[model samples]
Target: MSAVLASVAGAALNIGTNPLAIAGLVPIVAAGLTFLRYLRFDPEDHPVSVQKLLPEYDFVIIGGGSAGAVVASRLSEIANWTVLLLEAGPDENEVTDVPSLLGYLQLSNMDWMYQTSPPTDSQYCLAMIGDRCNWPRGKVLGGSSVLNAMVYARGNKRDYDAWEAQGNPGWSYKDILPYFRKSEDNRNPYLARTDYHNSGGYLTVQEVPWRTPLAVAFLQAGKELGYDVRDCNGEKQTGFMITQTTMRRGHRCSTAKAFLRPVRHRENLHIALNSQATKIIIDRRTKRALGVKFVRSGRNKVVRAKREVILSAGAIGSPQLLMLSGIGPKEHLESLNIPVISDLKVGYNLQDHVGLGGFTFIIDDPITFTRNRYQSINVVMEYLLREKGPMTSQGVEGLAFVNTKYAPKDGLWPDVQFHFAASSINSDSDQIRKITGMRDSVYNTVYKPLGDAETWSLLPLLLRPKSTGRISLKSSNPFVYPDINPNYFTHKEDILTLIEGIRIGLNVSDTPSFKRFNSRPHKMPFPSCEQYEFDTDEYWECSIRHFTFTIYHPTSTCKMGPENDGDAVVNPRLKIYGLENLRVIDASIMPNIVSGNTNAPVIMIGEKGADLIKEDWLGQHFRKT
Candidate 1:
């Protein structure tokens, strides 16, 4: 016999070894190889480090996050200028590079690990710890991008036109489209390269090279329901399509990798990891930002900014940092005993997509991700070699934006979004626990047995919530976490809208394409919502209240508006009012939440904000000449 056969036969012929025993070793060997590949792999070429201090830089960007990475990279293109990027977490390791491993990172050290304040009587997030939903924001260099589902969605054109109407000049759909196009590098040959998409840019936008059969069925179901199969990021978003991801060759192409890694060797740029900004150094007399005071290696250090300080620390961090720096509501600051500076509404307008998650469908076909070990081994090797397989799916395989009855007939934006996941949220045992932050008791009682079933799920997302919320200072100390109160479902209309969305999601399953799978509703009632009958409107309303949770797209805490608008914190150019040499350049500056995932829009904001800053300085230089 050959050497391979000889070894196998020798093992099988051992004193107590049966044929079944030898077969089991094959799977064990394959699993061991998968684990080794996951641990030894990393995609980043240049991971930055914290270097010695610089006395000054022309520009200082706080939070080496999604937008900050882009801003620092763009600003440093000028060889004469020096830029500094401060981040609170260390670099991403092998664990963060594999896209499917995203679930495991939330509880890791790279997460900020925030949670919403407990609801008063709504019973929202009842399944989570202490009745508060876990909010995991990435603390690493790429920030939330490293932790997000990696879907690339740009909101409808009318969303931007409304921004212009709200006193933000030059921000209409026509003006901002170029910036969006300028940032995308579309790699999917299947998608039509038109005015809506560009082929050469920094960020890679492509369809997942591999997808589950259920995801393909979802697209067919959309067509069966008489909806157009169109690109969501294209002219219309009313239909369903495979999601384009912020990934390159099956790995996450975070802003840190796309923007920062390629430019880290630039002589004038410096990155500081594990450095948290405690305060913005503002000269009280002149109302000008001078530098920043931060905590690094357990020692406080101050660094100067010669020109301007840009805040791209995201919605929660940006607004909280402003409040800590004495730049929020006067009464709240007084309550905390912090001296008041600019009394801007730093954290008043919190918004996020509230999703209702109980809608699931049991399918007769075993087409989901819950297969046996041999099939999983094939998927692992496929991804390892060709960068293709179910491993490329971003959990969310398809997205649909549609106007519910709540939206105006002529309104240009959709109020509800449906996210299609190929696998059942409850069917994945350890994954559901990590993704949802459910208590052990809740997980064991409600979701553990689901592992034995084959199912798919659709999450109805409230894109335009009538209710608004806020963030507040938990303590004046910068190290203390901020108190986030999304105040979900505060308005009764929100609950009603989501109920309509759930009805729509159910209606989609009645189509011929879905019927082929022998689909049936999996009606699992919540303990808190059991008072109402199954599938009734009352039951769904109760379910909406009980299971309502965020999709992690919070924005508008430092809202942009005209100069004299009372609620405005930043101006049309994103400059903070009553402050000189300072601006906020992240999603927090959005006047209102966009209609889709906020990552693509935030990257566009970084592109436009850099142009605005450069334009202003160039104007000053020309005037002097």
Candidate 2:
């Protein structure tokens, strides 16, 4: 029995256990790869033939994105236990390798390619940026991390403490900081090794060493605009500061590069690429999660779970899976002709942070990312030869925080964030983010130059939004995406706060330091904001309601909390309500969204969860029973 448990623990990458357990995994690796019958553990082996399906695993984790990969890698570290990671997308290749094409990956094969259902209100139609805005999710091996700009951040302490207060004990900032530290390999060679961060950790966290002179001037410009220059993720979230990225030297350090690549050697771990999880397998009469059903090469395959089935499928995918599994609102499932297993809040209380576009600016030097036809073999060769200049930059290298004149007054964290990217606003527009548009075409660059001036984007992000949204089912089909309603400006305060940010962006552009770079404020001639007599406070409010796009921060769906949380879908330990032997380890469990980028926090959750599971076993051993 001890040998069996020892083997199980060694297979998990993040599970902290004694050395003996690791040694026990040797045979499982041999048995799994050689012949499954060697150890009679056929359940852990992948099928060599297309006709055979491995019916069971100790753990089956859905979605191999940031959260899923971390959890699956850690859980499988236990020696003999079987683990299967199901991903809907393929691997990250050179397109993801090039930093210049980073923004273009959004709607590509790597992205889930979701969008908001057109609003019910007519004003929303008049308010769009161009056409439908693109929502990019990770479609490849590392999920979104494979394609993200690689901004590494830990949001405000208040955001976590708020979770504990709302019935999620041990989820406060103090409780989770150790996990964040545990996963970071702070590349700053000069930093201390004691408590701030760990050196041997799998995740890479570093600072962009080279910033254009314009970047520094932009920082000073914000300071001149009355915003404090402080660390965006430090003691205060307010003020302007450089963004800490997940890059090493000049390359993007996505999760696939960090955690997944190193651990693929572990024979116990297996990743199924192009495998899309369509639903969780639940015991209808028992009301317990049993396994998962997925599609591989257009064929439906059911994989059973012996111990647990975990959903790391992300905000949109997780809830969608639950609903399809007949574990959602009974009425909604029945309407689609699906038998109900258990009625729980699968898709409810969706929340997201959104902000308006910032003041536009053009560099006087004419040396932005958009220069030189956006594709110069000479430039690419320069980048490959020497890791210097714009090629090393991920465009937006600066960040700042500020208090909106009407934001929350009690905290040190600001309600606003300032993002400084190298490219102009129009360059990152709806047209460019589209995955499969006629990029490199003639009309886009030459014939359709709006206003005949080039402008890069600087965004003022509202950290704490009063706006609330919902995620509902589109149909009974598991393959179909959900209806995402961000309902921006539902709370009038969000619109007011954004308008105030626009005011600040205008102020910063007008500063003398910004004048040196000739970074003047420029707005697209959107008739909605100017025409139809839409200049008053009411018109501005109406425009905001229709014009906003998600900043890619969606959370609070399936939120963890105590009973009657009103918005919660899971317990404090991230266990989905009304279920056993199942857990959710992703942004979906975020009771309230963090104040900064969600990647760091998602990784932290995985770190903490490994300990929680191990600790549970330890506590059981120490019990009087």
Candidate 3:
């Protein structure tokens, strides 16, 4: 049994070096893969052949990601309007469907594998490889949704209201709540019945079907600390609850699955996978986006968009595409010898939820998830046959939104978000370390010694960061990767806020609920911070700087605001400020970063952006709400 379990673990991690162990699990592995294949786990729902490319389409959307998928699907509902979605990567496969393996998906071929270019004086990400952090954006059809842990959070009500206050009309919580509901098909009976949530939508939102005892204990601990255990996505944002995921029947339901698959039969919608859009063919004199130039199958192709061209290429890709198409800052474009078109701030105002990664709490019991404990034939079989097992878990089981001292006292808005993991970073046999770009010395000294011990962790993420970053063009070449400078912890207040968050997390772990299992902070101090006494604010601050982590929620590069806002790249209607018939409809257009995981809000943006487009072309009567 132990040998079989080892084989299963080896096969699952794809690091099985033992020929004998691999040979023993070949049959089981083969059967599971074949079963998933039979279920059509691949995102081949749409039959889009290269030969089917037409001379022109009414709308050319560059990217088949979270927002692009929704935009393409919704626009194609009109029979007369032709929509083309060009994705840089291929369709998702069975490997991406398994929720438990979310971490492994990063740094793989499916990920864009972006690395941040931290300034020399930056104190954060010090322990990472080359003093840089890995930014794993999905390169698949579903984009980052295919790579994320499937946390379905819409952020605080004030987040959208703030956007409206920032001169973006029709973006308040009340105004956009319908759009959130329009795309949600909530599986939870209670939430589905609420006015805030609805049923019979394209996206499936529900609690993770399976969780460990530690996850339940996490909620109890939150309650002990005077936090509510109610729905975090519903009436109140400041509370604790089991994580709601974008999943269906224990499988990851990416945007491509939810939005694109249903409309695959639409003759007006065409998806071009592995088509990298190099530039937006714009009429300079008219300032109109005419078409898109993309390369597919080693061939260059330009397709005309009769009406509009939309960039739904996410925060990173959208700004990069804009800059490459000569729509960035005048000075920066001139430095690269590219003629400036719009001369707007394309990649400024970048923000992400930065957190501390190695804050682990040890427990006496063996209840926490570890690769060795759950990687067995029975577990695999249960997931395959019944879609119920540890494999269904997305690792993140519980969540809490709490207000720090820095947060405003008038509202329920939280400045800190806690992600409760059933297992610690050390539980995955260095997979987290590899994905996060942790140095060998740090992982070997701090986490490696833990060796799959029963442990849990609460990752305290700064929900509202004061420090902003930017994405800049590396060269005029569209194929060249852009430089991402997250510039985390640049503000002293940001560090202070995170320190308070860490204190709250520690307080939760010290509660009676967690104390029942004899839970205690892991004693190993980070290598660079060993000089300071452990558990002190000084020590923790140093630890945070060394282990600074990105929650993968980069946004606000092409900020949406009124025309007078100097930093605004897109107008309130999501149209490019200085151009006609061009708009950015992804997370890039966020005026400010939302308070939680960005996937749900990004999908909402797509739904609302689609309506905005409809109103512009088909008149105001075409609006849904």
Please state the error at residue 392 of candidate 1 in Å: 1.6
Best by TM-score: 3
**lDDT score for candidate 1 against the true structure:** 0.81
Model 2 agreement with the true structure over 394-428: per-residue lDDT tens digits:
77788766677786676375676667766654443
Clash totals, every prediction: 0, 35, 0
| Candidate 1 worst ten-residue window by lDDT | 15-24
Model with the higher lDDT, candidate 1 or 2: 1
TM-score versus the correct structure, for each prediction:
0.92, 0.84, 0.95
Ranking by lDDT: 3, 1, 2
Candidate 3 — which residues are off by over 4 angstroms?
1-49, 623-625
Q: How close is candidate 2 to the true structure, as a TM-score?
A: 0.84
Cα RMSDs, all models: 4.7, 11.9, 3.5
- Name the candidate that leads on lDDT: 3
Which of candidates 2 and 3 reaches a greater TM-score? 3
The residue pairs found clashing in candidate 1 are none
User: Please, what is the whole-model Cα lDDT of each candidate in the order they appear?
Assistant: 0.81, 0.67, 0.87
How displaced is residue 609 in candidate 1, in Å? 1.1
lDDT (C-alpha) at residue 274 in model 2: 87
